[model samples]
Structures are given as structure tokens and as C-alpha cells.
Target: MSYVALYRTYRPKYFKDVFGQKVIVQTLQNALLHEKFAHAYIFSGPRGTGKTSIAKIVAKALNCEKAPTAEPCGECAVCLGIDKSSVSDVIEIDAASNNGVDEIRDLRDKVKYAPSVGKYKVYIIDEVHMLTQAAFNALLKTLEEPPKYVVFILATTEVHKVPATILSRCQRFDFKNIDTADIEANIKKIVNKERLKISNEAINAIAITSEGGMRDALSLLDQVVSFTKDEISEEDVYKVSGGLSRRFISELLQTIYQKQPQKALDFLNQVLQDGKDISRMVSDIILALRDVLLDKIREDKKYPELNGLTPPLIYAYLDILNELQQSLKYTTSKRAYLELAIIKMMNHQSIEYVELNQKIDALQKEMHNLETRLRSEVQVKQVESSKNIKVQSKSNLKPLVTVSEISEILNQGDREKKNLLKIGWPSLADYEVPQLRGVAKLLHEGSLEAVGANRMLLVYDDIITAQNMLKKETKEKVLKIINSKKQLIDDYTVLLKADWMILKDDYAYQYNAGISKPKLKEIDLHLYEQDEDSIQEVKLEEDPLVEFAKASFGENLVKVEE
Candidate 1:
């Protein structure tokens, strides 16, 4: 006799032989043990997950010589006949080929007959979702009210296609993908029984590649056994399965993370040169990233290449690879797309670097502006003192909020209210009031630092921008827009990013040291409002070109050559 395939040779003949579906097996056993099994059952799940195999086992359990038993006695004539497909009473139908109203009608006509040999007659339909609407309709009434001695079991990988009308009439059992460990153990048992020369690594490789499918694992193992002459190795599994080794994947990820584009390109070229599937390589990278993400969440250090990487960065990597996977399907130049994806990931690191440089430049400019303004004010003070005239210099301008007010706001900060403002802040750019929309747009230059019961803090990298946002007209317009949407905030203030950082650090230090916060009096809103007359007076007095020259050339480099 010709050698049978491993999957078929090791097909489960009894309930005890099935693996990785303990709950389903136990439920079926209890139902059978009490002789309360349903007349019609629907089994659904992914391929090779035992949906059809379990259906067969159920058929044997119902028709075995020892009827109503949880485990079928494969030695009995009825069980043997059912297993061999020789029993007239146990009918296995491939709905994919035989799905039709006439075939179903014929089945309906035959449901009235008594069992030919066993105590019960069972109909097992595989891929029942393939049945046409008319066919399903034909089987509906018979399925709903089958004879006592007759049982119907339908199996499909896609249960969503199964009509609700058909689903409502039968007991549904969803088979899950078998766990990898269980699949590995089962493979080991088979190897030991067959005395196959295979390494543990090879077994593990097969188990992972199968992706929770027992039939797939066994089939892959069979292919490897046939391809190898001696003891099977992990490399042999990878070669046969067209999958990359975990080490190669790790190395590739390290190159990508370390921003070594040449090495990444070399890895892709090697994969292409060796006739490996580019799409599969992308998929494997995604799976590796997924593993790294899990390790990150669990606070484990399994993937060292991803040690310092944050979850968002890993997600971005996965997103790039995922897009590559999708693009590979449409383009014939798979290598080009894969190469582009590698470059994209390597370049991802530049985004944060660019933003950091921008913030640094903004802070430097703001510092220079403040320095020039302070020097101008000092010169003006000297001029005024020489003339013996009282004048209010810009240097005398008060901050939008005092330290006490900021402290109070910090003490009264509400996390929930802050989150609400942060979430809604993005919408301010499109405020309904067209006149105030520009003012609202200016707020986006900064960030919502903290929100309190009645006060909100905005922080900007540029001091000038922060000061502009604090002006009475801009502040009023922004407040109007914000209050029109959400009436949570009654007042708001702006601070330089540097100042906000200092305040945040201080707040954290004080709170951690268990210092009791003192309640300060409510801030006077009028103090934050700039007087238009005072601003016009200062602008008229200060020389615009002198200010610009001071900002452009350093204060030390510029001279008053009047």
C-alpha cells in the first residue's frame, strides 16, 4: 500500500486524541455522556483547527457500537466503518462540490430513513458556507427538526457567511486555532512514535511556521522529512518553508534601528539573491516587531535591538512594514518597495531630531530678543533719569500671571478638565467665529500646559509669541472662541516653555516632598490685560531699525553711531 500522508495517518480517531481544544472537547463529552447532544450542530473556525476533524469524531461517538459514549472505541465495527467511510449511516458531504438545492432536497428526502446499521445516522457537511442560498433554505426545515436517530454536523472556516436563519436552528461550536505549544507536543509525540530523526529546533520552527494549525504543522513536518536524508535541523526547516531565521530577522531590525542603511540594503539583497519571498520577509519583520512590542509592555528584555525604543516608535515601524506588505501585492518590483520601506524606517529617526532643532532655535531667538529688549529698557531708564522725567519702560511690564497665581492654578489643576481641553484644543484652529479663528490659531503655536477649575496655562517656545497671546484683544478673542465651545475655563494665561519647565519641575519636587500647598487669592484678570495706550507709547518711543539691527547683529556688535 502507498504510504499515507502524515496528517491523514495521524488523524484523530477518538476524542482523547484531539489536541488544543479542551473546552470544546469537554463540552461535547458532557453533552454526549448525558445523551443530550443536539440534533444539528455547526462547527466554525480557521482552517486545520479541527472543525471538520472534530465533526468526524462526533460522528464516530454517536455511531460506535458502545453508543452514547464520550470516547469512541475505534476497535468496534461501527467506529471502524465510520472511520473508513464505509458505514452507510455516517455520511460525510463536501459541500463545496455538492452544494445545490437539488442535493440538499435529496438529503432532506433521505433524512426520514432509519439508521442502516448504527443506532444513529449522521450527516457531516464540510465547508457548509459554500452552500447556495437555495440549498441552505432546502436544508433549513430538515435541520431544524431532524429525526431522533439522525444527526447533522456542518463545518465552515467562515461562519459569517452562514445565514442567521440556519445558525439559529443549530448548536454552534467555534473551534479556535490550536496553541503552538500543544501543536509542538503533538508533533513530538508523532516523531517519537514514527522514530523520525528531527531536532527540537526543527520541531519548534515547524510549530511557529504553521501558525496555530495542526494539519499545517504536520504537513510541513512531512515535507521536511521527505527533503532531508538524516536528522532534520532548523536551517532545513527554514530552507524548506521559505522562512527567515530569527537571528537574521533580529540582525536586520538592529541595522534598521541603528540607522545602518547599507547593512539593511545588504540584508534585502541577500534575501532577494537567495530566492526568498520579499512579502514574507516583510510579514516576518512585522511579527518580530509585534513580539518586541509585547516584550516592551511586559517590561522584558527579550529583543535587545528594541531595548530603548518606545511603543510609538515600534508602532511606526510596524506601520511602515505593513504598508510595504500591502504595496508588494500590487507592484511587480517587490524589491524596490521593500528597499524603500527600509529607507523610510531608517529615516524615521530624523523627525524627532528636526523637531528638537526647531525648538532649540526658537528658544535661542527668544532669549536674544529678551536680551535686546532688556538692554533697550536700561538705556531708556538712563535717558529718563538724566532728564528727570518719570516714564514707564517696557521693562516695568508685569507677567501675565504671578508665581502665586501659577502655584494656585497648579494646586487646583484637574486632570479630567485638562484632558478635555487638550483633546478639544485641536479644534480651536477651525473656530466658528471667523474673526477670532486667527487668534485661536495662534494658540496652537503653544501647548496647553495645565488646566484648573477656572484657569488654563499655555506654554510657548517663543517668548514674543507667548506675550502676543497674552495681549488683551488676542486673549479676549481666544477666550470667546473657547467659551463658545466649552464653558469649562474662565481665565487663561501664557508662559514661556522654559518657565513652564521650571514650574513643572518645582511642582513635582514640592508634591513629592509632601509639602502642603498654600491657597493664594484669586488672580486679578485685569493685570493680564495689556493697556493699548501703554503699548502704543512704547512702540512709538523704540526705534524699529535699531531693534531689528540688535536682533540681527549681536548687541555687542551693534553701536549707536548717530
Candidate 2:
């Protein structure tokens, strides 16, 4: 009299009718035929993989009046009763709601009674992982040593949460996620049987979005069918599901790759305006990038847009987008954050080089903290000592900048001498490659000093920037880009501005060169917390004891220990 959902209407009544999980079905069928079925069985896998449906089919087959048959006789009273969920002997328990020691104890009491009409009294407990420890302990004995007429079937999406004692007592069968092709085929069979007119694209879209879940796919189809009177299309599926189109994603990425920040931002606004979730939009972007990466690696020519994109850049896109997606949950203004992240990603020189910048920033912060700690320790010692006592001056101590001695090359033959001689510094900013362009811009912050046969040295205004130049990815990208222009050097190193002043003095003293000794100031170190906008304050529940102490002690005397 009432319309049933597609998933429920098409629920498998027999093993042959179940889509996907062929191996599991065959195993159960053979076990039933050979009379080798286990007293207790465990079916575990991802949701919508037909764990419960398979359990019901097995129950019907075992309890059929036909007796020990591989296939149940649907006309028989026992089979009909099980199918209608009216059978007294075949019980289906929702462990998610009924999981308790008392409930399990009640089940144990009922298990001793013989079947009313069939050979076996079946107990199918779904979501068995929800059972508490005590409930599991109660079920363990029954599962391990049940009556001859009893069979226990436990199903869970998460098998790990099931107790080991309960697991050890059952014969386990792991259900795999249904393949997309199998899901598509299953949908097609449903469409034809139901006389529903659906486009191939709609079917494919449903299959892809279901993500290997048959019930989910059917549910989506049912929703689409209810929305559209006839002739379902891909657009209808996307509209109903709030999914993005590949064309729009491809266009957005193209705009970003071309460094059109405003255009990309506008497009992002359009997507959000259309009621798409910001987090879901980021996920779609990441998925598109993943497809491009796979296409590039496999050289499949599936995504022509990814033809020239480098793997490092693709990886960088994934990393930044993933971080953006994670940060969205903490903010109320999702649109603003999404816009800023998109603009940064588009304008950033190389996705890979961002890693180097983050590393440098972290290291610089750590170095400053270390310096502050040392300074505080020195000040404390000075205070402890007599006020008239003189402390040693750190001003005269030279900055710690070390380099390999060059005497060996200087004393070598003409070839070595020529190889070690300085050459004119080339500008890296003019490189064409995006990866190269980014590295070159960062490298431009320092002054190039000398170029040897295989190595070069440069000086930077700060120690941290110089250290960043030495990062493996940054260094490799710099060398690759520079070498592409001219094979001048293969490796390079950096020196701080203060240290460069000392090096200039050495060169002037040793070679009688016109280089002058430049005076340098020690860097000022100050500590500050990271940007307030980026820091998310998490609400942690207070411990009951701490709360009680604070309430009783007027909050002032309460000291919370870490």
C-alpha cells in the first residue's frame, strides 16, 4: 500500500540475487550444501556491502523445511516467515540498540529452546561492534558452545571494535567494497526491471559517488528518480547530490595555474553561491589533482590538462588543499578563508618551495627561543654574582660561520685553479619554469659570491634565509633550474651577512684584493606567538576533580597539573 525505498524493495532474497561479494556467497553456498556450516559466523566489511542481507539469506536456507538445501524454498512456511520477518525461531537483533549484559543474558536464556519448525534457530546480530565489554563477555560463552540447533551470525562495519574473545569463536568472512562496475551493473538491472528511464551518465555518476556502496548507490538513484519525472541526466544527479562537475573543476584549475587569482576567486564564489559546501569543494579539487597526478604518472593521457604539470607541484597542491580543508572546520567564515587559501595557492611560486619556507620559519622561531633562554640564563647568573663583578662581553665573539678550507685548490695545478676561480653571478629570477621561478626568487634574496666546477657559495642578509637555501628540495630545485639555463655548477652553499663580512676580510688579507671588511650587528631576537587568526582554541572538558577543587577553593588556590 505504501512506496518502499529502492534499497528495501530490491533487498536480496537469495544468494544469486545479491550483487557483488560473489566469493562470500559461493563459500556460504558450498558450506550449506556440504553441511559444513559453522555454528557461529562473523560477516565484517564496509557499510552497504550486504552483510545483513547475506546473513538473512543464509538463515532462510538453513531453516527452510527443505532442510540443508543450498537454496531456500520461498514457498515453504519457514522461508516465508523469515522473509516476512515474522519467524519465531529466526531472530534479527539490532546490537546497536540492544547491546547490554541484560539483553545478552535474555538471549542466552532463549538459545537453549529448540526450533519451532526448522532444523536451526538463527540469531543475526547486526552492528555487533556496538556491544559493551560485559555484553561481549556474555555472548562469548554462547558463541563458543551454542546448542546444536542454534546458529549465531554477527555483522559489523568495524571489526576491530569487536572483542577478540567473540571473534575467536566465530567463522569470519570479510566482505569487500563492491566494485564500481558491479554497482553500475546492479543499478542497470534495477532500472530495467522497474521500467525506469535513466541516462547512462546518470548511472555512471551514481556509481562513482556511491564510492563502492551498493545500498548508497540505490538510495541515490531513488532520490534522483523521485526528483525527475523521466529521462534522468548527469546534471540532475549532480544537482541533487551537490557534486561538482569535472569541467568546472578543470576550468578553475586552469585559471589558478595561469596565475589568475581574481578569476579563480570569482569562480570559487560562484561555486559557493550555488550551495556547494566549501569543504566539499576543496575535496573535489584535491580529487581532480589526484586524477591529474595518476594520469601523469601512468602517462595514460586521460587528463590532457595535466600534460605539463610536474609531480612536485601536484603534490604541493594536494598538501595545501588538504591543509585548507582541515582548517575550514575551525572557522565560521568559511568563504573568506577559502578565498584567501585559493589566492595564496595560485600566487605561491612553487607549491614545493612553500615547504622550505615553513621549515625556515619554524627553525627561525626555535633559534630565537633558544637565544632568549640562553640570554635569560646569563642575566640570572649576572644577578646572582656581585653587582661590581664584570661579566665577559659576547660582543667580541665572532658569529659561528664555518667553511671548508680552500688551500688544496689554491695549491693545485692550473686546471684546479681555473675550476675554483670565481665567475659572474647569474640571476635565477628570470628562469621560465614555475618551480625554477619560485626557487630563483628565494635565492635572489642573497648575493652570489663564487662559482666553482661543482659548487657555489652565496651570502644572505639573515642566517635563517641562508639555511633555507640548503634545504634538500629547495637546493635541488635551484640547481635544476640554474643548470637548465647553463651548466655552471651542480651544488651550492650559503653564508650569513655577518659571516660574509669576515670572509671578505680574509680574501682581502690573503689575495691582496680590494674587498673591504664590513662591520655587522648581532641580530635582535624577540618571541611572539604565531598569528592569532591561524590559532584555533580547542574547548577541553575540565576534569571532575579539578572542577571540584576550583569550585571549593575559589579558583585562586587551585593549581592544575599538566
Candidate 3:
């Protein structure tokens, strides 16, 4: 004459009794009616979703004399045996306790025998993922080709740990967490049956505490019921559960709205003094603040999933209190943390929240102010630089290129006179070669073709030679040269283009490697393949400085071998 816990007392005995598992129940039922059940089935999902319960139901449906029936008659002998867990044909194993390879081998041996009492022998293994690798291997062969009269039902909370080979052999069904609404409805039925006068709010609190686990929810209800034989109160539920009252939490917000830090701390201190846990207090606060935050947004189904808690209250609660969660463990003094948190909110101007929204607003304002100041500073610098440039314009204009007198290199000769103009005295091409420091030298000397106004092209006498010199590294360096100098000529629309107008016999630089023909082909093939599916075709445009990149690397690097 011992009391059966509420969860077990109300455990689903038939498919019609299982809550929030209609989808899974329907699939199994259909499979049963059609005689299409798999030899091995894997049921995987979160806790309390009834993986084992469904497995048992399947066992019952299969073993019942009249089945291929969706609703197994609990009155039948086979159903009664399964209900009592004494069915010879149905064996339930906890893989967590018996996860050794030997256990799996033993099960495999047992599965080969014919059903002793029913049409099929069903083995339901819970926590199947806990089985060791060798156990999984041992189970796999049986799964692949089990006797027609044998069924293996493997249930697991974590399916990923199950080996792919085993998984590949079984039919997998993922169970989902039961919704709060479903749990709440069931709790109401229980309260009605027990003849207890319970408030909707107290029932909800229990549902939320259960966190979608029906057994936990019912166990909690059983505990709450023991407090009073005929009735349960919300206060009694709160006191027993170690959770904050929704009103106490709602009042915390009223304090925040009123901007009363002292009063708020006093309320928080009273709650802690009443034996309420600070972590649980913070958790309650976070939930309240989240509700408050949600109030400012759209309402989703998750709010209803909160049992009986109202949406607006949850919104207000989650908004203001979720803040204290991270800082909860840092303080030994719970009242002090509450005191500090409330005081900081009271003086929003002085608080430093690294990621706080208030601080973010202030920081954004600060950023705008700083940006305006930086822009003013940059403008001032530019003006001063312009003034300095005017003063030095005359001196610097003396064609600072040391070889400025060599008109061919500068490409700035006298077009009208048909001869290179000499400027800056002593035939001015002499401004220190303007150091085509990077691949600017290659462009200056002539190698690829400038196909776009934005491109620096280098063209050779033969296309093969031009493509050959476009080594991956060399192309990158040349691109940097084109972009950098093009930035210098702000208004001119400067495009770099190079052509070996004359195969210069005078320029000679020996290359250590062979033609590098193989490397060139690989590079072209790689780049070409990427563009083969679709090409960005456009009218070819010209750039002016590409002659420099090809030539700068040395004449042989770009010019055809003559």
C-alpha cells in the first residue's frame, strides 16, 4: 500500500494516453496496421519525450493477438504482460548499465531465437548511444540481418554518438520535447482526478519547472500535493520549489520604473532573507526581464510555453532583470549584488556596461562626436599640406626623375614636335629614375596588355610570351603598382598599358630557369578554369603605365627571347 508517484501513476499506457507524441504515435500505428515495421528502429530525441514509452507501445501493438491494430487492447494477456513489464516477448534493457560488447553479443544471440509467446520478440534498449564502440559493432551485424520475428528498438537522447554503421541499418525517429500546453492540460486532468482545488497559476509553475519533462512535472506535483491533502496553493508551490513569485518579480520592475533603488534593494533583500536562493532569484529576474524585452517585440509561441505565466509580465521581467545573471556568482553577498545592480540602473549616466544597451547609446553618440572631430582634423591637415605643396611646387616640378632627360621612359615627350621635350634644365629626364620600386619596373619596360581603363596592361610582340611572364606573384606585384600610381593622378583617368613597340636588343638580363613553360601553363589553366563557366566580358579599355611593370623585372622577364 505504498503511494505511486503522480508521473508513474498517470504514465501513458495506451497510444491515446501519450501526450504531445501524436506524430510519433501515428507513424508507428500506421506501420503496425500495414505490417511494414522495421526490424531495427532508433528513437532519438531530448529527455522526457517518451522514446522508451513509444517503444513499449510498439511492442504491445506487435505482440497483442489481435493487432496490426493501432490501439492495443490493454485487457489482452500480451498487452497486460507488457503493461506489467513481465512479457516474455518484450525485453527492455538500459544500455547505460549494460553497454559492454559482451552484453551486445548476448543480445544478438538471444535475438536469433524464435518468439517464445508472441509473433515477434521485441527488445527495447534505452540510452543506446552509451554503448561502447565494440558494443555498437557487435549490435550492427544483428541489426543488418536480424531474424524476421525479432525487433530491436534503440532509444537514445544523444544520437550522434551512435555509430554511422549502426545508424545506417535502423529506422531513426527523432522525438521532440512535449510542449508546455500539453503538459499543462495533463496536469489539469490529474488535479481533477485527484479532487484537488489548484489554481491555474500553481499548475503552470509546476509545468514550467518540469521544463517539458512530464515525469519531472508529475513528480513535482506529487510533492506539492503532499503539503495539503485536498488542495495546493501557489505560495506553497513557490516555497517548496525555490522559485520567485511572479508578483515579487513584477514588483521588482515597478521599483525600476519608479527609479527607487533603495526600495528595490530592500525588496530583494527580503526575498533572500526569506530563504530564496540568489541564483534562482537571478534566474527569475532574467525570465522577467526577458518578458519585458519581448513586450517591446512580437509575441512568439515560446511565451505560451512558459506554463501559466502571462506574456506581459514575462516581457517586463526579462527586460530589466536578465542583467543580474552573469554577475550572480561574483558576489558572496546576494543583497549587495542586488543593491549594486539597482543603484547602477538608478544612475544610468555613470554606469559602465561593456555591452549594455544604455552604454551602447552613449557610445554611439560619443562615436558621432569623435567622427566629426576627426573629419575637422583631417580637413585642417589637408589644407596645411596644400599650402606647403604650393610653396614647393616649383622646386619639386623640376621632373624629379633622374632620367627625365631620357624622354622614352617618362612617356611625356613633345608630341607636337615629334621629339622628347627636355624640361627642368640639363635635358630633365634625369630625375632619379623615379624608382619604379615594385613591379612598376615591369610595367615601365613593357609586358601585359591594359584591357580596361582601370587595368595596367603589358603587351608583348607575341601573345605566348606575354602570358608566360604572368607568374602569379609577378601579376599580384604588378597590380599593386598599377593601383598605387593610378591613385596619384587624381584627375587624368590614368590607365597603365604596355606594348613591346620594339623588341629591344640592348636590354639583357639572364634568367636562371628554363622558359618556365610548365609553370605558365598551370597558372593559365587554373585561372581559366575558374572563369570557364561564365565570363565577365567587356569592351577592352587601355591603361598607360603597364609598360613599366613588365620592363622593370628585367627585359627577358617580359620581352620575347630573340
Candidate 4:
């Protein structure tokens, strides 16, 4: 007799023998025990996850001579018949080949007949998603309301392709990929039972390569056992599976961390010479990086050579390798792509450092330009002071508007007018009126804080901006511009932000304390004005350095000091 593969030889006979699907086993057993099982059921998951195997076990349990048992009696004639696929009542259909309306129509017609030798006739359809629309439509009605003695078990790896109409009628069970630990334990049990001479490292390599598939693991084990007569080793597994050993992967990563491009390339060339797959090598490296990342996050010390690497660096390495892995699929020059990825990983830090240095240089140039502009402004102010012009010092500057005026405006502030003026403030920066250009520039430097009747208050971040806005010529031009816009403001004044905040707080305290408004006073507004000649019109020229700073960083991040 031909040798049976391990997967088939160790195929689960009873629910208890099924591995890595405890929840599914228990649920099906309970459903069978209570006799409340659905007439139609769908099993969906990855391949080799026991979807069809469990379906067959369910058929055996339903048809076992001792009826309604959770665990089937494999010795019964009906159980033995179903196991051998000799039972006429249990039919397993491969939907990939028989997916058509004619086949489903035949099934619909045959459902009316009674079971041949068992109490229930079970129909197990594999890869049910392969069925065409017409076939699904033909099966829908019968699947929803099948005969009492008929059971339909639909299994598919890609459940998304299955129609909602067909899915809605059946009870769906989603099988998960078997865990690596569980797969490892199962492989060990098989090895011990078969008396196969295999090392633990070989078993682990098989389990990891399987990627959570039990059948794949067992199939790999069978191949490895056939290849080697002596005790199997990890090297044997890697050689057979076209995978890089973990030690080689660790050494490659260490060379990368040490920034030894030559050494890393040497390792790559060696692997290629050994006939290992380039894409598989990249995948192994990514997996090794993943392990290092987890160790770093968990504060564990597993890879000492990788101890110098940071999480962010590992993440970047993974990103580069992952991109290379994707690009390898469509490219013929796989070696060139892998070489380029290794070089990128080696120079990642240097590249990031260069970029950071460039940013710092730009910021230094901006600061120097700012300092030069401030010094020039200081010189102009000094020249004005020599002419005996009354220029208020920033620290000792007084508010242009009196406390009484502020109190009167705040007490009777118009919410609607203030909101309107606030909305229109941004437009002043791009004003087209030539005569009001300087006024627009000054107003744009400050913000409209309050509006009362025909009076307004503007606040600025610095004393220089407030003083310039309060200059006699700037204020007159502003009034003319406002009148042109039909705003008709009687007067406006400027104050520093710090002073405004204090005044605002005091006013709020008085209002909340129910204090009455102060008596109105007709004070001379000329006291607040500065000589027109002393405060020159702000130039409209755009500073290229400032613009560059704004463009390099952003407008919101760049601030003009003066």
C-alpha cells in the first residue's frame, strides 16, 4: 500500500481528536446534544483550518448508529462508511468544479428523497464562494428551508464573495488560524508518536514557517522526515523550506546596526550563493526586526547585537524592507532591489541627520535676519529721539485710550458690530486703497478687540506696534479708510496685549460685582497722538528672508519680531 501522508493519517476521527478548535468543537457538540442544530450551516476561514474536516465529523456524529451523540462511535458501520466516503447519505461536493445552475437544480430535486442508510442526509460543499450567481440563487431557497432530514454545510476560504442572501439563511462559523504554540505542540506529539528523530529547532522552524496552518505544518514535517534519515536539524528545515536561519538573520541585522555595508552585502551575497530566495530573505529579516521591536517594547534582552538599535530605527528598517518585498513581485532584478534596501537601512540615520541640520541652518538664518531688522528699527528710533520726538518707551508706554473711554466702550459694547469688524479685519492686510496702505499695514499688525457705537479698540502683541498704530497720521488714515468702507467709526486706540488683558479682567470683575458704569468724560484725544514725522509709514516691501522662513516652515510657525 502507498504511504498515507501525515495529515490524512492523523486526520481527526472524533471531535475530541480535533486540534486547535476547542470552541467550535464544543459548540457543535452542544448543538448536536440538544438536537437544535441548524439545517444549513456555513464554515468560513483560512485553508487547512479544519473547515471541511469538522464538517465531515458533524456528518458522522449525526449518522452514527447510536444517534445524537456528540462524539461519534468510529466503530459503527455508518461511521465507518462515512469515514471511507462510502456512505450514500453523506455527500461531499467540491463546489469549485460543480458550480453551476444545473448541478444546484439537481440537488434541489434530490433533497426531497430520504436518507439511504442514516437518519440525516448531509451535503458538505467545499469552496462554496466559487459557485456562480445563478448557482447561489438556485441553492438559496432550499438552503433556507431544507427537508428535516437534510443538512447543508457550506465551506469557503473567501466568505466576502458569498452572497448575503445565501449567507443570511445559514448559521456561519468563522474558523481562526491555529496558533503557533498549538501547532508546535501538535507537531511534537506527532513526532514522538511516529518515533521520528527530529531536533526541537527543526520542529520550531516548521511551526514558524507554517504561519498558523496545521496541515501545512504537518505536511512540511512529512517532507523533512522523508528527506533526512538521521536526526533532523534547523539547517535541514531551512534548506528544505527555502528560508534563512534565525542566526544568519541576526548576524545580518547586527552588521546593519554596526553600519558595515560591506559586511552586510557579503552576508547577502553568501545567502544568494547558497540559492536561498531573495524575497524570503527579506521576509526573514523583517520578522527578525519585529522580534527585536517587541523585545525593546517589553524591556527584554534577547538580541544583544540589536541592543544598540532603537524602536524608531527598527520601524524604518521594516518599512524599507517591506517596500522592497512588495517591489520584488514585479521586478526581475531582485538582487539589485535587495542591495538598495540594505544600503538605505545603513544610511537611514545619516540621511535623517542631514535633514535635521538643514532645518537648523534655515532657522539660524531667520534669527539673524530678525536680529538685524530689530537693530535697524532701534537705530531709527534713536535717530528720532535725537530730534526730541516724544517716543514712548515700550516698558513705560501708556494706553492710548483712557480707562474711562475703555469702561464706556466695554459697558456698551455691541456684539454684532464687533463680530462684523472682526470678520472684516483680515481683509485689511490686502487692502487695494493706495492712500490707506500704511494704515492697512498697521491695522493688520493688530486685531479689533472691541466695538462700541462708532468707537473701537485695537490690541497688539508688542509696544512698538501699538505705538505705531496710535501715531497721529496712521490713526487719521485709518479713520478715512473706515469711513470709506461705511463703518463710520468716531475714533480708535491701541494697547499692548498684556495691558488689555489686565483691563479686561478688571472690567469683568466690576461687571460681575454689579458695579454701575463710570460717569462719561469728554477728554482731549490729542494727548494720545504722536508727531506724524516721528512715526514713518511702514514700507510695503516683502522681506525675502521672512518669506523663505514662512515657506520653509509655515506662516503660522513664523513670527515677525518687530
Query: Which candidate number maximizes lDDT?
Result: 4
After the best TM-score superposition of candidate 4, give how far the Cα of residue 560 lies from its true spot, in angstroms.
33
How do the predictions measure up, each by TM-score? 0.64, 0.61, 0.57, 0.63
Worst 10 residues of 1 by lDDT: 382-391
Off by over 4 Å in 4: 297-304, 349-562
Predicted structure 1: lDDT:
0.81
| lDDT tens digits, residue span 1-562, model 3 | 9978877788888889888878888998999999998999999988877878888888999989898798788888888989898878899889999999999889987887898878999999999989999898888888899889999999998999888998999998988878889999999999889888898888988887777888878888888888776567777788778888777777776676567877888887787777988778777667656665565456553233333343443444344445666666676776676676666655544232322555577799998886655543433332223222122222222221121111122233223222111111121223233543434444444532212222222333322233333555555554444444234111111111111221111111111233211111111111011132243343333211223334445645764433
Off by over 4 Å in 1: 297-302, 348-562
In order, candidate lDDTs are: 0.81, 0.75, 0.64, 0.82
> For each predicted model, how many residue pairs clash, with residues at least 3 apart or on different chains?
0, 0, 65, 0
What residue pairs clash in candidate 2, if any at all?
none
Q: Is candidate 3 or candidate 4 better by lDDT?
A: 4
Q: Which scores higher on TM-score, 1 or 3?
A: 1
**How accurate locally is residue 21 in candidate 2, as Cα lDDT from 0 to 100?**
92
Q: What's the C-alpha lDDT at position 262 in model 4?
A: 98
After best superposition, candidate 4 residue 92: deviation in angstroms? 0.6
Give the winner by lDDT: 1 or 3: 1
Cα displacement (Å) at residue 410, model 2? 46
